[model samples]
Target: MKAARIHAYGDADQIRVEDAPIPAIGPDDVLIRTVAASVNPVDWKIRRGYLEKMLPYDMPLTLGWDVSGIVEAIGADVTTFKPGDAVYSRPDIRRNGTYAEYVAVRAREVALKPTTISHVEAASLPLVSITAWEALITTAGLQPGQRVLIHAGAGGVGSIAIQLAKAKGAHVTATASQGKTALVRSLGADEVVDYHNPTAFAAARDMDIVFDTIGGDTQDASWAMLKPGGFLVSITAPPSAERALAEGKRVGFVFIDPNAAILRDLAQLVDGGKIRPLIGGEFRLDDAAKAQLASETGRTTGKIVIYTGQP
Candidate 1:
């Protein structure tokens, strides 16, 4: 098999496509024939050694996290899936990832791919969807009939977060470029603030939750948009301890985990037409470097997919 792997953490130039051995599965795992994967900012972060201390990976690592494919084989203890089943998963970040032509993922981390979408589309959802789920649903305890603000609404996590919040009956407010106002609104955001305008969200106070995907200034600005006692959840970095203490708010930083139950629920929402995956671009497996570059730029509208083309 050919995999895009890095011998040492550095830049995009470090990623090289080369021959590699097929992975052996444990009794609780399933071996998937790769069809497609998606690029995320964390992929590049890990590649450049930013997460080395936290993730503690061995050298010569494959760096993708999202996958949509067909099950080629299942291990002895795996009964939830079978040979020839279509599945998708945000595989455990500790293992060899989904960048190659094959990935062995724990059966509990895999779910049947939504039947309504293509492999490329299914590949786009896992990581981002899981991030949103952990942030709003698991961490913040967002409820219906409330208000939620999503930063970078056209982004991977934000786009899906807007729709999921709306599906739960929350009034969704999102920030995006002027050009993406319609796009975000179409995705169920009740209001779309112009991200380029510093004061565009000044009137967005009294929210039940704020989901921040953009850090730095954007995150700083989001602090003023929540009412007292509202929750603030971020996937980019940890919330400001000082600000949370002064503002009487609950702040949390979400490190996403793989849960088959969340993926199954998302699949139902997708197949029922209540939500959908947003695919911004596609690249071949050999072009993993290029895809990672695009994600690093922080300008992609949604998920950028990598097609492995393996049967």
Candidate 2:
């Protein structure tokens, strides 16, 4: 099988598409013949060794977590899916991932692909959708009629977050550049704030929840936008516990823990026409490095997908 891997972490130049032995599965694993995968910021972050201490992956790692593929085989302990089943997952990041012709993922982490979309589009959903779902629904306990603000609304997680928040009947506000404001609004954001405009955030005040995808100055500024008891949820970094206490607000940091249950619910949303995956670009598996470079740019309107030319 051909896999794009990095033997040592560095730049996109270090990724090489080469032959690798097909992965062997454990008793609870499913062997998937990769159809498509998507690039997330974490893919490039892992490639650059930024997450070494947290993830501790071995060298020669295949760097992707978001996958949509056909099950080639399933472990003896796995009963939920069978050979030839189309499935999608944000697989556990500790293992070699879906940036290859084949990948082994835990059966419990896999869900049937959304029937409404192709594998390329399905591939774009798992990671970002799961992150958005967890942050908005699971962690924040966002309620209908509440106001919510999503940062980087044109980017991967934010794009999905906007739609999910709206599906939950929340009043959604989002931040994007001037050129992408229409895109964010189309995704169901009730208001789009141009992040480049210095005073743009003033219009976003009195939120019930603020989903922060960008850390540093952006996160710092978001605290002021929330109502006194509003929740600040971050996927980029942990919001300060002390700050939350001092400001009489709540904060939670989300590290995506793949859940097939959530994927199933997301699929239902897709099939029911409540949500959709947005593909910013597509690349051949051999061009995985290029995909990572595009994600690193932080300007993509949606997810970047990599199509593995496998039947």
Candidate 3:
């Protein structure tokens, strides 16, 4: 199988296209013929060895995190899906990834893809959708009619978060550059704040929930926007305890776990036309380097995908 992998992590320049033997599957795994895969920022982070201390990669590493493809074969113990099932997922980051023509994913992490969209579109959803799903629904417990603020509203996670929050009937406010206001609003954001405000939310208060997708200054500013008992949910990094206490609200950090049940439910949302995957761009799978470059720019409004067909 052809795959884009890094022999040693350094920069995007280190990425290369190479021929690798097709991976083998365990009894609990399913081998997918990847048609499309999206590049998450973390893919570049891992590619450059930023995760070396924590999630170190094998010498030759496949860095993609999102996969949308057809099931080519199933492992002995897998029964949830079979050959020809259109599927998509963000496989667990602990193992080899979906940057190849074929990958072996744990059966439990895979979900049937949304019929409403193409494989390329569905390829963009798993990681961001799951992250948003976990942060808003599981950690913060966003409620209907509540005011929630999502930073980076046009981002991969925020775009979907806005929709999911709206789907739950929450009144959503999102922060983004003026260029993306219409995009965010189309996804159902009740209000769009120009992040240029540096103090856009300074005079604002009583937000029931804040989903912080951007860490640094943006995460810090989310404190004042929340109501007294509101929840500040962060998917980017951990929240500061002192800050949470000073603000008098619950602080939660979300680390998305790939669960079949969770992916299945989210897939239903996609199939039901409740949530749509937003694709900012697509590149040939071998152009993983370009994919990584685009993700780091922070200018893209949504997911960037790589189409992988053994060439």
Candidate 4:
């Protein structure tokens, strides 16, 4: 099988597509013939060795976790899916990843691909959608009729978060560049703030939740926007516990724990037309490095998908 791997972390240039042995599965895992995968910021971050302390991945790592593929074989204990089943997952990031012709993923992490979308679109959903679902629904416990603000509303996680929040009947506000406001609004954001305009979000106060995908100054600014006791969940970095205490707000950092149950629910939402993927670009598996570069630009309106050139 051909896989895109980095023997040593550095830049996108370090990625090479080359022949590698197909991974064997464990008793609780399934072997998937990769159809498509998507590039997230974490892909490039891992390539740059930014997550070494936390992940400690072995060298020659295949650098993709978001996958939509067909099951080629299943482990003896895996009963939920069978050979030839179409599946999607944000597979555990500790293993060799999906940027290859074949990948082995834990059966507990896999879900049937949403029937309403294509493989490329399904490939785009798992990671970002799971992150959003975990942040808003699981951690924040967002309620209907509440107001919430999502940063980077046109980016991968933010785009899905907006739709999910709206599906939960929340009043959604989002931040995007001036150029992408319309796209953000189309994703069900009730109000779109131009992020380039520093004062644009001043009026966005008394929110029940603030989903922060961008850290640093953006996270700093979001604190004042939330009402007292409201939640602020960040995927980028952990917010200050002391500050949250001082301000009488709740704060948490979300590191996605892949859940097949959430993926199942997200698929139902996708099929029910309550959510849809926003794809910014597509690349062949051989161009995995190029896909990472595009994600590194941090300007894509949605997810960047990579096709493995398989059926």
Candidate 5:
């Protein structure tokens, strides 16, 4: 199978298309005939060896994290899906990824793709959706009728975070460019704060939770928005626990685990028309370098995906 892989960790030029052996399935895994995969920030981060210490894949790594495809075969213990089932997953980050024409994913992390959307759109949702899900729901323990502020509202995790927060009955305040207000509003953001403006902090106040996708000063200011005992969750980096405690807020840093239960919940939300993925752009499997460029440049609105099949 043809795959876009990185033999060395460096610039985008490091990714190359090569013919590699198809992925072999384990007893607990399924082999998916790839239709589409999405590029998350981690794809490029891992490609450049930024995450070498935390997640060390062997050299020549296939650098995609999300897949929406058809099951060509299933392992003996895989009873959740059958041959020819359409599925999607945020494959475990610890192994070879979904940049190939096919991927072998653990059955526990694969779920039935939502029938309401196309493969490209389905591909866009898994990683970011799971990340947002873990941040807003699992980590923060958000309750209905509360307020949650999400930084980087136009981003992959922020876009999904807005919708999931709204779905869970939280009033969401999201930070973005003034031009992106409509996009953020369309995603169910109750309040769209323009972070590009000089008065961004003055506009965002009194929140039950702060979901910061951008770390740094933006993350630090999120602490001020929270009332006493509110939650602060940052997916971009680990939270400063001492600072959080000083501000009288609970803080958490989330790392996504690709569980079928998480994907299944996201799938059901998609099926119910509560959450929709925002697809910024797409490239073919051979165009992974372009995808990496889009991610690093930070110009994309939401997810940038790689389609392995015809449009």
Candidate 6:
């Protein structure tokens, strides 16, 4: 099998495409012939050694979590999937990932790909959709008729978060550049704030929830916009406990734990035409390094996918 891996944690230069043995599966795993994989910020962060302390891994690691492909083989105990089944997953981050010709994923974390979208599109959803789901539904508990603010509305996570929140009948407001206002609104944001404007979020106060995909200054400013009991959910960094307490609000941080049930529900939404995968770019498998560099720019409006050339 051909895989893109890093022998050491460093820059994009460290990523190399080379020959590797096809991974063997556990009794509960399924071997997928990779059709596509998507790049996330976490991939570049891990490659740059920024997450070494938090997510320590041995050298020569494959660095993608999102995958969409065909099941080429299955292990003894894997009954939900079989050879030739189309599937997608945000695989466990502790093991080898989907940046290869094939990936071995636990059957429990895998879900059928939505029939409405292509493999590249399916590959883009797992990580970002799961992150958004965990942040909005699990952590913030967003409800119908509630107002919620999502930063980076045009981003991979924020784009989906906006749609999911709207699907649940929440009044969604998202922050993005003026150029992307139409894009965010099309994704179901009731209001779009021009992030370049210093007072962008000033009028968006008293929200029921705030899903922060961009931390630092944007997060700090969001505290004032929430209602007394509103929830502040973050995927980039942990919200300040002191600030939340003093402001009479709730704070939660999300580390995406892939769940098959949640993925199934998300698939329902996708298949029902309630949500769509946004693809910003696509690259061949061997261009993984370039893809990582592009993600590091933080300018993409949606997910960057790597097509693995599987039939």
Q: After superposition, how far is residue 149 of candidate 4 from its true place, in Å?
A: 0.2
Q: What's each prediction's TM-score?
A: 0.97, 0.98, 0.97, 0.98, 0.97, 0.98
> In terms of lDDT, which candidate is stronger, 1 or 5?
1
Q: Candidate 2: lDDT of 280?
A: 92
Model 2: pairs clashing at backbone N, Cα or C within 3 Å: none
lDDT of 5 by residue, 125-159 (tens): 98888888888888899999999998888998889
In candidate 1, what are the lDDT values of residues 218-240, reduced to their tens digit? 78877888889988899888998
What does the lDDT read for residue 267 in candidate 1? 98
lDDT of all predictions: 0.91, 0.93, 0.87, 0.94, 0.88, 0.91
Q: How much is 251 displaced in model 4, in angstroms?
A: 0.8
> Which window of 10 residues has the lowest lDDT sum in candidate 1?
195-204
lDDT of 2 at 29: 97
On the 0 to 100 scale, the lDDT of residue 31 in model 4 is 97
Residues 46-157 of candidate 4: C-alpha lDDT, one tens digit per residue: 9999999999988889999999989999999999999999999999999999999999999999999999899999999999999999999999998999999999999999
**Residue 247 in candidate 3 has what lDDT?**
63
Return the clash pairs for model 4, or none: none
Off by over 4 Å in 5: none
Task: For candidate 3, give the lDDT of residue 48.
Answer: 74
Ranking 1 against 4 by lDDT, winner: 4
In candidate 6, clashing pairs total 0
Which candidate would rank higher by TM-score, 4 or 5? 4
Over 173-251, each residue of candidate 3 has an lDDT whose tens digit, in order, gives 9988988889899988989998886566575567999998889887888887888988999988898978778768899
